[model samples]
Target chain A: MKKLINQPEQIIDEMLDGIVSASPSSVRRLEDTTVLVRKDAPVDGKVALISGGGSGHEPAHAGYIGKGMLDGAVSGEVFTSPTPDQVLEAIKATDSGSGVLLVIKNYSGDVMNFDMAAELAEAEGIETAQVIVRDDIAVDDPENRRGVAGTIYVHKIAGAKAETGASLEEVQATAQKVIDNARTMGVALSPCIMPTSGEPGFELADDEIELGIGIHGEAGIEKRKQMTADEIAAELVERLLPEVDLADQDEVAVMVNGMGATPEMELHVFNRKVQDLLQEKGVKVYDTIVGNFMTSLEMAGCSLTLLKLDDELKELLDAPSHAAAFKK
Target chain B: MQLTVEDTIQWLKQFNDRLSEQKDYLSQLDRAIGDGDHGINMARGFQQVAEGLDGDFDEVSDVLKKTATTVMSKVGGASGPLYGTAFLKMSMECKGKDVDAAVLADMVEAALGGIKQRGKSEEGEKTMIDVWAPVLGTLQEEDFDAERLKQTAEEAMQKTEDMTATKGRASYFKEKSQGHLDPGAVSSYYLFAELADVIGKGA
Candidate 1:
């Protein structure tokens, strides 16, 4: 209620306008759609990498649209799914003669809408392939699960493949590989307030936290008396490391993502513990990213994502990229 | 004859009152399985709906449309959009008529369609639809009574405790959403029952 806004209805639109203005000139917002793309996108023969979801998790789908990450991103209103039309526009806007690869999260609405968009895109002669990221070990659906924080890895890896002039099929295959090897888990200490309503989605006592929560304001798997950051990290890593195919000789890209409200200090503190746990498991950590990559508005929490790397995946992940939120 | 603006305001005021009456219960249900803001969110939305009413409208449906738009714009979160879209669809269906039982019934059906389209929810997903689907079934029957509608809606809301939520945040529970009513669905059912009362007996 005490936020700066001319009107509540205009919040999403206004925010999009601001992002467009502040973003690199290469990044352009497609006409009347919530999709953002590179100005010189679809450079002749490279496969186009596209990703998107609800809007509140800013610096996500949009900010990641740049040189080495996403070729385009479709955005919905806060925590809402973008219509298939919006996603289709993004597909068209970014597709050159080459095909496009869609990196979708596993949420039902997101999956349905993105799939519809892909079908529409393919109908229009734009070859499209899709890879769903369901790396959140927090949920039990092993094969067809909701995409969580591990989506960041897919974005990075696919972006690299596309930048290297990989075919759409190749890029799609790489993204699926990343998805197959990754696992993630999250915990929330406090709920976040949506900017328009100025009300928290849920309430937690000062001494409690929810485990195995989804990104939306939904309830978590369990709520228990609060534990230290180290304990929280241990439990999260325990859940994540088991599902990921990390072996003794495997190199991995580990991401520690903050769930909107948690501060930088906490992320690093949590990262330290995560590093310790991985070391103990003899999992060779090739790369580490600790920041607020994907968020749930202002929810105070974090999720850990681990991607087991083959030589090719590690190279793609290490490819140089420029996006607002990610730096390689 | 169509309803006056005053009648519209009265309905919203009563609706807010109904939300307040069930606020604690809704919050209690939410506390058990999901976020505990359903009661407060519903109350806040209806309160905003009440505040938005002013002057006379030519059609009862227009008033309903305004109410729907008001809640959609003012309320945030899933409840704001879903409930708001439902009412908006219902209002679109009710254009220019006096508030009659059949029209109300049609409005309910329209609202359900809007929810189904927006939420992509099925019958047993343990969302607001669980409460709504049953209530609509009862309302559509010849044996439907105002009291029976109210009672059945509450019963359906309670029945959510037995089903596992397969949508939204509660779905993460996998099976833990069982034994707890969805707070949003419970309040939605209450709102429906209250609207049924206002429309059913012509009180």
Candidate 2:
């Protein structure tokens, strides 16, 4: 209710306009669709990399569209998946016969919509491949895991691979490799309010926190008493480290991600324990990124993502990139 | 006995109105175990469908196809593609044909089939499939009873309250998902119930 928007239904449109306005030189919106593409798109012979989901996760699918990130990103309504036609438009607008690689999150809506779009794109003679990122380790079943902040890692690596003039298959393979090696676990102190509904996504008492939450504010695995920054960081790091094999002191690129409304100070506090805990367990931190790379509107929380890195992933991670939300 | 373009528009309009009225109810049902946007999504999609219905259309399939695209483009959720595919399949089945009771049954069957393939789901998953599957049988009957169709859809939707979901995000809840109505099933019930209303009016 306290949002500074004219109307709830216009949030996506207005936000898209604002993003394009801020970075007109880098990104552009596909006409009449909820899609943002790199300003110099269809980069001739390169395979196009497109990734996106709901709109609340800013600096995400759109903000990462530039030279070595994403060729395009389709936005959905708040916490909703982008529809098939919108995705198809992105594919058509950004592909240059090298084919396209769609970096899809492992949610039902995202899977179905992108799958349908791929089918439609293929019917129009556009070759496409997709990698489903199921990096959230909070779920008991691996197949049911939700893609969270770690999806950005896939974008970086895959987009870099594409920029290398790699074939669609090669880009897709690298993207899938990132997906297989990444894991994320999140905790939420407060729920997000959907602008249209003006309703909280979920409820949590002041003394409680929900662990293993998805970016859409879906209820996490369990609710427990709110803990100190160290305890929360310990819980996330412990759960994440076991998923990726670092038993031999393997190196990992760490991302201590804020879930919106959580300031940099708190994330750094959380990352402090994350660093110590990994060091104690003989896991080498290859690199670290701590910020709100992906968010859930104004939800107050944070997640820890671990990307078990090898020589290839590390090189790709360090590659040059430019976008509204990323530069390296 | 066969549906005309006029009749199809009436049917869709009725579906849109019902969804518009029950939007909050469907979302409330979803909040229990799912992301809690079903009512809002369906209502928004159908409102667009209703607005777009003013165009010139010569066949039922044309209207259905347009509605499919509108709902698919506007809904922007799991239900968007699911319902969009359902209508698209139904439109494909009814294309260039008179959609009588038997043909309507086939259309519903085709829609159900599309939903299954699109969602990677099946009956008894506590989804809209539960309602669509049973209602197909009633549509195929020689009697073609409107009341019976509505009752079957309502009963099927009610059955979801006691079952655990094994498909889509609801499946993530496992046992905890039981005792809550599947939001998709409830919205689908409104869809069929409105179809029955259109039939009863002999539109």
Candidate 3:
């Protein structure tokens, strides 16, 4: 309710303008639409990478747009999927002769809207491919899991593959590989308030936390009494490591992502436990990222992502990225 | 009675008024199980439909087409495309054709089919299909009573209170989705109930 903004409706427009202004040399907002593309868009003969969803998951979809990451990202209303028209404009602005690859998170609205946009783009003779990321491990039904922080890993690896002049199909296949190998789990200590609604999505007792929370303010798979940082990290990592495809040889990249309001101090504490747990399980840790890669609007929590890596993935993950919010 | 374009506009205008008046209430229902945007999205989409209806339309199908595209473009959620596709299929089913009871039945059936295709859903999924399917059944019956139509929609909407949602954002809640009305069903009730009133007055 106490968000720093003028009007609820203008939040997206103002936010987009702020982003463009902050990084004018790197990005530009497509005119009259909620789409942001890299300044040198169409990057001439490279397969384009695009991803987007609701507005509150900051430094995602958009912040991931730059040199070796997303070519463009669309913004929907707060917690709402972007309309097909907005997505269509992004496809048009970013698709070069090499075609475009849409990296979509697995939410119903995002899937439907992006699917419609891809169809429209195809109708206009732009070859488009799509990869859906559904790496959240909270939901009991594997078919219905939401994509969480693991999506950025998709954007990173897929963008690297595309930068190598890979075909749209190749980029999409690589993105799918990341999707198949990565899994994430998150726990929220509190709920986030949408600007328009001015009300928290849910309320938790002071002593409680939500496990398996989605990026949106929706409730997680289960609620439990709040536990220590180590306990929470163990709970999240235990759920995630088993979901990875690491067989005999176990090397993985870890992302300890904050849910907007969580700070580095707490995230590192959680990260330490994640590493301890992974090491205890005899898993080789290649590289680790600890920061707010994806976030709900000011929600207090953190998500842990484990991406089981092979040589191809390791190489792609090591590729340099100049994406504004990407830490590397 | 042949439903004229004016009557269709009047029917929609009434529904729009209902949506504008109850936008917050509908959103309240959505807040419980879904993302709490159904009412706001529906109100925004129908407002454009209301504006789209202010001008001249050559046929009822044309009016339906305007509503479809406007809602599809303006409404940004699953409801937008679902409602937009439903109206579009209804319009296509009755192009240049008289809307007698049988034709109306066909239009509703087409709308239902479009909802299913676009949402990849079926009845008992706690979606708008739960209301639309039974309403179509009532329309196809020999005795097409308007009161029964309204009651059917009301009861259908009410029945969703106990149904576990298997689709849309509500599906994430699983069994917790029960005890709350599906916001789509509530809005679809307003849609059908308004049509029932127009038909009752032989509009």
Docking class of 1: incorrect
Model 2 lDDT tens row, A101-207: 99999888999999999999999999999999999887778988888888999999998989999999999999999999999999999988888778887889989
Taking all chains together, the TM-score of candidate 1 against the true structure is: 0.74
Q: How accurate locally is residue A152 in candidate 2, as Cα lDDT from 0 to 100?
A: 96
Instruction: For candidate 2, give the lDDT of residue B143.
Output: 78
Worst 10 residues of 1 chain A by lDDT: A193-202
- The local distance difference test score of each candidate is 0.77, 0.90, 0.89
DockQ of predicted candidate 1: 0.14
lDDT of 1 by residue, B135-181 (tens): 78876787547787788888887788789877765676768778777
DockQ (Cα-based) per candidate? 0.14, 0.75, 0.65
Each predicted model: what fraction of the native A–B Cα contacts (within 8 Å) does it retain?
0.13, 0.66, 0.40
**Runs with alpha carbons beyond 4 Å of true place in candidate 2:** A247-249
Q: Which stretches of candidate 1 lie over 4 Å from their true place?
A: A1-6, A119-125, B1-122, B128-158, B174-203
List of chain A TM-scores, every candidate: 0.96, 0.99, 0.98
Cα displacement (Å) at residue B113, model 2: 0.6
Better of 2 and 3 by DockQ: 2
Candidate 3: clashing pairs of residues: none
Candidate 1 displacement at residue B139 in angstroms: 8.7
